[model samples]
Target: MNGASLATGQRSLGDPSVTFPLWPPQLRGCPETSTAEIAYPVEVDYAYEDVDTALFAQAPGPDLARWAPLLPPLHAPTLGEGGTPLLELDGLPGVYLKDESRNPTWSHKDRLNRVTVSAAVGAGAPGVVVASSGNHGASAAAYAARAGLPAIVLASAEAPPAVQSFVRAYGAKVLTMPAEDRWPLMRRIKVLTMPAEDRWPLMRRIVDRFGYHPVSNLTVTHTGHPFGAEGYKTIAYELFAQLGRVPAAVFTPTGYAEMLYGVWKGFAELRRLGVAETAPPMYACEPAVGAPHARALATGTPAAIVELGPTGAYGIACTVGGHRGVRAVRDSGGEAVPVTDDELRAAQELLARQGLWQELSGAAGLAGYRRLGREFDGPVVCVGTSSGFKDLETGRERVRLLEDVDVDVSLDDLLRATDA
Candidate 1:
């Protein structure tokens, strides 16, 4: 079992004393979430004292199973996730880019789905369901298919066509609805009015009726699968080994802040095991269009729901924030960074020049770092979450133009035509 028994129990982030056994798989959110304004996420606790420091020694590779004991019971089949590269860029001094687009589904969500799907398998659940605009849904679909189970993706109709096709290609049931309606339907709270009745049924009563385990959030706020965030801890472990020490700062793209919290937890675990003395401060990067985490942090609230604005970077443009993010920031003495679409596009372009084609939202770490506009004491790390191919622009029908730009014209005219 690779010492999997070291995982002691699960506890609520709001009230750590509210705990439960990890065995039978706590796939559901905090059942004690009583208030509408304050839905808390639960987290996994481990016997870190029992863990041997020698196990921290790792080589470069794309397999998270090696850290199986540090992670949740990974009953789901592997799709070659984790162990992404930590690269240095020219413009940002002492900052390394931890590119996660290398995963099976070309997104960091692969790490999360690996554990979430396994929870489904461990629990003997029928299948899995999730609500995502892009990467999360695709990763869930791929993992579910690998586990020989069906998946239902409650995606936004506004989601890029390529992402829509990517999810369906995995044989998942794709139900595209208005972005706002997806969450309420998952909670089975209330359905919203839409243009068509067809999209309505796609989001309703998935868990209660179909008996499918929800791999995404169903709480009033964004308390996703407890095991999912644990998957992201692998990133921190990989970073420590790659850099030869813990960094002074780490920037992460944040929608629900699961990844932000997970990264912090991994480093915290290292401190607990005495492998490292300190955990780096995590910076949660969210689109200014709707930075709920940043808003909550400013107001001294655990989490908040913000009035959202439109932006091209949809992946990290979340409305509801989670308490885990708050805990991570507060515990680590970190702060939230809100990024604008202009900054996201600029960051994407910058990384692309560095031969890293991160998606608009994927470049959020750089955007946040740039927004901060300063250098750190020690090495800094900025996480790149997804590929540029996952961008909405990649789905548009402009690729056909590349077949022939009519190079018959003069060199000057050709350069002008191609916008070179």
Candidate 2:
């Protein structure tokens, strides 16, 4: 970890007064907010006044470590995450896409895993555990592998098969389970009482009390790793530097809204430090099948849960609302926009046509922007969360709805096959 890190300690987002030690990174979410069906997460705080304002004079680094003064203690090695390109779309006027698929493991989750896995190494844990749909688990496994720690990922059996394979490639044990069962299994060890074969050998190794760091949520609602979202602060820093000014609006693909809040926090820090006069409007883009954050905003609740419907944009199709998300949307004067699968598909196709193939859900920000249909006072940045390759239908299957057919070895046949 950098000695220049200005991190003071952890504070519950629910109650800023409730603070905890910065060391031995908080694996469990805030206890103060724990309730029957909701719980708020904790966020790391830093001595911003102590940060050298001159550091911003130079361009940001390719690694997140350069901004260490504003982030949590990074105890894990870097996987070359962060510093993704801010591409200005040719046809979209001032609209830019902060394409996060450029990160290691090809998703924004790499930013988070880099911080969360480091917490395990800092806490002296033997390994890390996480429950993910696809991008999260794959990124966690890669980071844990880099940290030389064993990782057990509880992944949904329904997630893209390619992503499950990606997790296993990092030497992590993948325990495929129902989407609903993944979180419960990650939080409790009662399932270990099942027969040896039924419970599986890997399940016995998961004893959180025995010093395994959980990189995911451990509460009734979602309160992921304390330091995870901190890693995402780099996105805001990068955007500010890339645009040479704060954007008027930022549309983020919100699963738990961890990344969205992280980005908002970064901009907020800048505003507090007098670097910027205002923070951008933060939009939480969710799958239309279930926009719990939107429901929470409408109901005036800290968080709310929703019944999920079938949608291909499963990456951000979370059933439960996260407080971090509500805070980001509310604090930034942003709206929670839900886009249908058709909207997502349109955005995905358009990006692909523009030579940027993004995951179905990764196009949510652009989809949401189009759905909102408003002009911004300044530049608008729509976040692209991951690669289209991570979609349920593989890259080869996406443009092809039928089985492959062999064409005859003639110029005429080739032309006929492609309808040239």
Candidate 3:
């Protein structure tokens, strides 16, 4: 079957009857609810068929559009976002690294933006708006620019300087505000309401008033963008093609778990298409502080929100966990693994020694695996989602210059100074 063989639509994760078209700007929340504050999870649906293996086996093209058959319609511009290398560490026999830092914006968010911006284009929106602590804003701004649309980013004042610079570099209008104030501004450009007590009301305003497409989660529970996660499916396809089959385990760094869910769905689709016999167990790795997914799994709930503690791995320190992540972990017999900042830092250092400078949060998968300390039956893959350059702590080291070098110093004296 070709790319056009499938029809894409949206279905509410909480209520099946509450459905809408994914292309046009649809209801941000379930229409059945009287409370505008109630946000529901929504997902994209597509018709399935047995297609030839060649569809995935083909050498991956530069952009995410290469997997058009499985993704939403391509209504936006391309920036060579996909086809990142699957690297192996010499010391780790069964472990492989899905290095996603190679994406256009140097993070996995590029994959998400490629599809979400396309959604904006499909709906004929003038521009895009997003609320991100870092990588998401940078990717959205870059993709929106590529799609010939103005971009607006609502970022926290606490956002890393590098990420703020990246967003501005893409020419997106960057508004630094209190985290609570971001969602309200997302609704009406002029109406910057006092920080609302909840997130859902402002989410509705963002769609109903601003006519701007949202690339990230708006729900109290993170349903994520129906089209955005489709971009991450390419990572699964690439892994299968590169490994010749699905690995035994796939470890992913989880915040809202959008990428984790997407990767699991991609592998499930592969199995459905008879491309592989079974999908791997997915591990959702998170910072030790506020691991909502872990709490949700333990409590037998679809989603949960937990109290957060301080963590240097800010990118993945999400307080709220999504149903998508819980489902992926449950269905695959996977577990939520929470790692300390120290563990993640060590993992990042390990990657750096291997010539892969990954963000501390992005090294979570390896940290999880190290915590697991079990022998896998076959190959295991850990996703490294971004570059170390994006981390707030990443910077040049300070070194002491031994006394200012004297012009009269001899070569032997210089050698002695160096030894000293």
Candidate 4:
């Protein structure tokens, strides 16, 4: 009864057509400026709602027309990008697979990229630059393309072969640099790249603001697009509609920590709005080879600083920890778990048995869950972040094929073998 009504065709809360506020109140707090080197303005906010308001009742995208007046003037009606499936695993008891691979880019990174690109467009950046080894780069590239903005992806040549192909497939300028130099170069580009004053930043914006085409800013990071994370909130909403109760835990594979943050934030908001009775503990799963976020959580450090090492799960091979990672684990009283290559492979096989084909990195959440399942009770959802196709770059699946094989298939032979 409290949901935003699409039938009225009236724009209200958080809609550009309305007038109160642009961002949801939760994102209104200033971003932690504790570190001067990477200080960036916090651009998201939310409204004050009671714990029982049932936040899911309001579907942002479909309700955009109703809430348009309450958001930024530049904000427009959005696609329903957040609603996704939470499929149960046949072989694993109490385990569910949140298939984020179904997103626009075939990965959970779409949740972050959609919002991040919107930020670039809103800020009027000429171009966007990103330092990524896999999913993030592809997500950024595709969204940049969708916005009709120029994008530059600074990736390590050592990245998995499939990810390299994904970056190029999106028409993003793939700059191959040494692994050590990628991040630094991304920072340099951020400082040097700026759009012309007249640039529109996106095709839609160009048509809305001026007739001139816009350049894409290569500096956009973080899913600060208020409406973008709105896509992610759908995960929680669907969970509620499906289970009729909240889950006990939600495990996510971490890189930029956007997926974890998005799900955690969604449940938290739902709990706050009285849509859900409780929030699930959000667990972050990382590859052991470079799990700075996990180490940081264990050490009680604000952010962990360590050198990233190579791992088969390239998507989550992150070193530096993000602020959202800290918030995600802390808010839900959750823990960060690290899994090894062997564990990821095993989990991938387990998922295969359940008829789910996930990339090695995508299976890391299940791997961590398997390792820590004993400690957690009740229903748990592990995010399958991407499809196996993204693992093509490693070239680790070389197999020898036999041109011909001598074999017999007959009922008598099968009976004899069984008897033997």
Q: All predictions: root-mean-square deviation over Cα? A: 4.1, 4.7, 4.0, 8.6
Clash list (residue pairs), candidate 1: none
lDDT of each: 0.84, 0.83, 0.81, 0.60
Q: What is candidate 1's CA lDDT for residue 9?
A: 81
lDDT comparison, 2 vs 4, better candidate:
2
| Model 4 stretches astray by more than 4 angstroms | 1-32, 36-43, 49-80, 178-231, 375-377, 392-396, 399-420
Ten contiguous residues minimizing lDDT sum, candidate 2 = 190-199
TM-scores for all predictions: 0.91, 0.89, 0.88, 0.72
Query: How do these models rank on TM-score, best leading?
Result: 1, 2, 3, 4
lDDT of 3 at 97: 93
Whole-model lDDT, candidate 2? Answer: 0.83
TM-score of 3: 0.88
Q: Write the per-residue lDDT of candidate 4 for residues 1-420, one digit (tens) a residue.
A: 133321111122213243323423222212333243231223234433322343345533322222222122322223334445778888677888988777767777676565556656766666656666677778878878777777766556456667767787878876653334434664455322222221212222322444221212111222223334444555666666666678888888886575677677678767676656789988889888878777777787655656766677877776556556667788798888988999999999888787777889999889988988655567788889888878744457555544333375566755555441
Rank order by lDDT, top first? Answer: 1, 2, 3, 4
Lowest lDDT 10-residue stretch of candidate 4:
5-14
Q: Clash pairs of candidate 2?
A: 358-388, 359-387, 359-388
Name the regions of candidate 1 deviating beyond 4 angstroms.
1-5, 177-204, 397-413
Runs in model 3 lying further than 4 Å from the true structure:
15-19, 25-40, 50-52, 178-206, 396-399, 402-420
Q: Please write out the lDDT profile of model 2 over residues 249-329, one tens digit for every residue.
A: 999988899999999999998889988888998999999888999999999999988989999987888887789999999
What is the C-alpha lDDT profile of model 1 across 212-277, one tens digit per residue? Answer: 888888766778888889999989899999999999999999999889999999999999888999
lDDT of 2 at 400: 24
Estimate candidate 3's alpha-carbon lDDT, on a 0 to 1 scale.
Answer: 0.81
